[model samples]
Target: MADPILVFDLDDTLYLERNFALSGYQVVGAWMQARYGVTDFAQRCTKRFETGAYTGIFNHVLRDLGLMDSPDLITRLVELYRNHPPNITLEPDALRFLSLPRYKGKRGLITDGPPRTQANKIAALGIKDQLDFVVRTGEWGAGFSKPHPRAFGYLEQAFQAHPEQMVYVADNAAKDFVTPNARGWGTVQIVRPLGIYKTPPADRAHAPAATITSLDDLTRCLTQF
Candidate 1:
């Protein structure tokens, strides 16, 4: 039987996913400047993305910059941004957390997003080999996205582990905890200052079993298992 599972969330949970976004912006910015001679295009694009105004962001950026006449700009930028390979490093806390001698072999991961995009990140972070089971919910279809339970259910089945025997660590309170918490799994949120989601979610079901400011806090709790 598989040892008890320790699942993780990718993106901002394990590494600063903003780093990935920033990398894309750098590429997009340079591509724009070279092709259109736009000054400060990259910085403006980065600011827009960081503000969470992503819908039609490329078109909006162009329009704001008086490049409104550009044809197919949004589609081209979207494709470029999504395809750009990200240069990222695991946070030192993540390295320290994973370096724990006890938790090494039990690790697994569950993440949501475009399969190829997310796959690039996992490969970039070099965490694939460390995982015993992996599930990218987008590969499973829209119905399986987090808080849907099916993705969590998939992990349980993959490892032949039950909810009580699994521990899930993710940073997003908006969607990460609902299914695991409802199923009786151990859920912990790493609310690091660097994490993207900082405010407490309004829904009570989204609350985790425990909350920690860092990954190192998990060592003491996991030893209980």
Candidate 2:
């Protein structure tokens, strides 16, 4: 028997996404304007993330925020993200799954990010050393983004596994699960919203290979898989 691939989404999947208060680029724009008298920060954020380029992101944000666009902007922006910190909370089930002695296959992270920022968050979560691989859409240098099969395909190539053999877990149904399912990967939806609230009316939610309301539900469900 061969090992199946386990491609996990870090933000909304393994960790509770809503906990971090991650809004779109528009929110980042508002934050920058309020902090540094910079208007139109959102357009820069949107372009940087959409194109998978970190250099432009930091430099643009810093310049618009009234900081000099020197080489130090990268360092400054990094410090800001690290020290400011987002709302990061991991599910108990995620900890259990990652801490298990063996997952019976090549396990990896298929997350979307500009790289350094995501790496910082991953390290803060203390899961950096436990995984077999970490695939960042921008870090790969191919200019790709998640929910895109190309990003997922990179892990498939590295693990030498088929999409159907993999189990993908995430919170966004339309962006995370639907695309993977179309590509034949098993999908699990994590529904733990902030304050443990269940949004989007549970009854009408789209069906996944498995549905879990809490981290504790992972063990039992994975056992069946």
Candidate 3:
């Protein structure tokens, strides 16, 4: 039988977002403000996304911020997001983790975001060839939300494995770990120390299957599995 598959979250899990020039929401907000003269539009743009209606969440942000008064502006903002310089950095130990011999498993990336921007980051990092699957939200006809079953389904099908035959490592405890744990996939929390915004004290209580402080520590953490 083939070894179990390994599913990973793209941003912050595989390649750390050391310092993003602009977060997804920030990018949308900046476009709204600069293109439409609306101030404080970032908050509104983020609010719509948080509410689970992401069908052109950017387009809506533009309309609410007054940039959509012209259709051409909408097209330009879309183009900008696609071509924006990636601000994410590869975690120092990413190559080591990828090189581990014991991890003889099909590898896949399961991330949620605007398809174009996320694809750019994946391509720029040059790891797409290593990935057996690339599951994106808008591009795959799936719901644009994390912790959604559909997202998991796309991954399982791509990797050709059952839920129990995969281990998913991600950074966020709430969005990344908890639901997958509930879904019966092995879950590891990447415990890279975040400067002021540390992992919530609550995640310590909940406890992931393994806690890895760095990408290099991943092999050690998975020894028992």
- Compare candidates 2 and 3 on lDDT and give the better one: 3
lDDT of each: 0.80, 0.65, 0.68
Error of 2 at 205 (Å): 13
- Ranking by lDDT, best first? 1, 3, 2
**Can you give the TM-score per candidate against the true fold?**
0.90, 0.63, 0.67
lDDT string for model 2 (26-104, tens) is 4555666786777876666655554545345767666666778676646654555434445465667788877777556
- Lowest-scoring 10 consecutive residues by lDDT in candidate 3? 193-202
- Model 1: residues >4 Å from true position, as ranges? 1-4, 50-56, 69-71, 223-225
Clashes of each: 0, 2, 0
Q: How large is the C-alpha RMSD of every model relative to the true structure?
A: 2.4, 8.3, 6.5
Worst 10 residues of 2 by lDDT: 196-205
lDDT of 1 by residue, 72-137 (tens): 777788778887778898987887877767664477888988888888888888888778888888
- Candidate 3, residues 1-225: lDDT per residue as tens digits? 555677888777777553332354567567767855767766775567556564576677666655544577657766775567665666778777776777777888878777877888887777888788878776765565677767787777776677888788887766676666767788787866531124552554234678787878766665556
Deviating ranges (above 4 Å) for candidate 2:
1-3, 18-79, 82-89, 140-143, 195-207, 223-225
Which is superior by TM-score, 2 or 3?
Answer: 3
